[model samples]
Target: MDNQFPIPGPSVPGEAAPLPTPEEATPPPPSYQAPVSVKPPVVKPSPIKIILPLLAGILVVGLLVYGITKFIGSRLPSESVTTGQTITLTYYGLWEPSSVMKPVIDEFETQNPGIKISYQLQSPQDYQDRIKTALEGQNSPDVIRLHSTWLPLFAKNLFPAPANSVSATEVSTNFYPIVSKMLISGTQVYGVPITMDGLALFMNNSMFQQKSLLPPKTWEDVLSAAKTLKEVDPLTGKLTRAGIALGNTGNVDHWPDIVSLMLLQAGVKLTDIKGAEASATLSYYTDFVTKHRVWDDTLPPSTVAFANEKVAMIIAPLWRAPEIKSINPSLSWQTVAVPQLPDSDIVNWTSFWFEAVGKNSKHPQEAWKFVSFLASAKAQQILFDAATSDREFPQPPANKAVASLAQNNPVVSPFVTSFETAHTFYTASNTRDAKTALNSRLIKYLEDAVNAVSQNQDVVKALVTLNNGFAQVLSQYGLVAAPAAATTP
Candidate 1:
């Protein structure tokens, strides 16, 4: 999914307690002393002699206890406070099953010896709300799995990777440039991504071969191919086969990503997305239905349509490939980098989950240690290996070193290679943030804008509304859009 960084709110100081009055501070002095009434009473039998011996005995016992306690404490392991007792870190995670994560957790525990990972797989349904609740509650998990777009919601409640564990330089240097943009704020790194994913064009290889066509590389190429591949019933003027999946969010997965990509490719600043640049981009996206008529609302959802061979091409993240394969085991398909604007630098979009430590965690140090390990090259490779064993295709590793080794793999190469040019915004879908979530709320505005354009309405007003929605939602999370850099693909 999509994600961003955050600015923590200023802390409010507690009111100091008022000082006590003299009467309350001073207690009656020595009530045990005998009353020195006007007449002096006979002294008790050698009271001083009896008290001195008792005091001597008490002091001897106290010294003995102190020495014994010191001896025991000194003999114990130095890490006993944090490790000897064995801290069990509760990790709330999603997507990865126990089998896939057990190996990675086990490896971390073995190395640390003092930390135990209590990994719990979470359902994606209402995960943003659930996680937010957990993070704010008294018993939050030590580590949590969050979409990159969720940083704005959870940043204040999260513990940035401590210097002793993962550093800002390490994050920027090792992972995709987008990771730094999403997870880093100044000197603090908020989260560590285990995998990298983004939109890619999944095309039916057989369909292309039959038409003697190749995968499109630019907007012009995409249009031409869509025209040739699309099949329309001449008499009825109905679509029999869709050239590609686009135009409407109703049947399109990742429509938010597709729209954001078009905007970025056109150099429309997402923070202030309005004006001609945005209007033209939105029109072009909706035109796949309104003007070109290659795709329409009548078709099945993109993934389902592609699986059933009703569409020649669809844009989706690598994770969806497995679902498509399950739908049609015999279908011949290939993935390519998302099409870019002609004569412009390649700008790709990415949305993936990362591991973050809760600020309220009792063991923040140990929690970050485990998260840092998860982000390491060795752990990423292990995770990739385990995931491949448990499933057919896993999202490419976020670590560049690990991703580089997988560059030769056909299904993974297109996405892995696109990281250098990858960027992401909050308009990512399927993150399951909450009804009131930042991404979900922002997506609603975007959907409205797309629907307006597809229906041939005044898109400028829609764009204006969408831009305001972006600002409002981002401001709620204390975030202002940091525009992605213009880069050559």
Candidate 2:
């Protein structure tokens, strides 16, 4: 049976009556329920997508840093190193650049692409000191300019030419006989001469002609001229002019020149294959200035006398020729071989300038090659020409053949002739110390003797004292190997 109210359709067992009105209907509070179990969709990434972009960014940053660092480094100057392939050389000298030397150096460089050269110039007065300091400091130049007199000082430390560069026999044959001997000591040849110079009598020709005097040919003539020129003003009693400017205190390295020339003239061997001679030779030097007064204080210092024309003659080197011409172009002058004592044969002093190698040189082969080039006849001839024309020093070439090229020039003829008879000054094996002693003690003795003569001291006693002092110095250096044979002058 159907009830009229629709029997509360769909009524639950535990029913609560609900008003059907829309406004009155209230639903049970909403209840939360657990969600249904369903697996989430899986996603996979591609290797390229993950790694390529990251790697590209990293690479770009790395490249940028590298470029910046390289750019900064590029701004710095390059310092060269002579590794296994390259070579470097160092040279010292009185280098006056000329078109001649420039081409020679350029040619050498062009020939040896693997080599580079460094050059240094030193003044004549400081040459020895600079060399000694360099050697002791272990900072020596690969090649150095050496005066022949200073060779003995650097002998032991020198690097001889290698067998590959030149044989000893060839060296002797190639160079002048005297120069070859000079380069040798014991078993080793230590250096090669690049240039030569010698002492000569430089006379003011105009002055001689004015006085109606012939150029002095003998020591007596020189003495006579000195006396004639040694005039005192009647009122002032002061000297006006000195005939010959024999070397004095202010001249650079003048005493040795004076002593050596005199000794040679006197037939005194200052040194020999045996060693230094102590007595006869040095005593003669002492007597010449102190006792004879041939070279007296009456003459002014070299700089004053020569510059002022107060001296009519001077014993100077061929190198001085250019300077003289420059100083007084109007003053006519001529050079002659230095005069000899009446009883003695003429002998002049020889001096050489050379190139030497340093022990610590990075490129010894390159250094030797450069030196060889400099010593070559072609290079020497160029140097000779340049020295004559540009430098005014007219350095005589080391090569006799090259020197002969200058023979036609009248100004150079006398110097060339003088070179043939020149003798090297004696220098002890310990040359630096020996030269100092010579300039100081030996030179002072001569000076003192001159002063004594000026003060009217007995000439004989002064000479004896000088001789004794020289003997003591020789003994100190072991140079006086034996008792000197006594001789009466």
Candidate number of the best TM-score: 1
lDDT by residue (tens digit), candidate 2, 101-219: 56566667888887766655566565577777786565668888766655445655567766566455755676665566566644455668777777777777767887788877766
Candidate 1 matches the true fold with a TM-score of 0.82
Q: What lDDT would each prediction earn against the true structure?
A: 0.82, 0.59
**What number of backbone clashes does candidate 1 have, counting pairs of residues 3 or more apart or in separate chains?**
5
Alpha-carbon RMSD, each predicted model = 12.5, 38.2
lDDT of 1 by residue, 94-175 (tens): 9989999998998999998878999999988878888888999999999999998877677777877766999989998999
Best-fitting candidate, scored by lDDT: 1
Model 1 score (lDDT): 0.82
Query: What are the TM-scores, per candidate, against the unseen true structure?
Result: 0.82, 0.68
Candidate 2 displacement at residue 23 in angstroms = 99
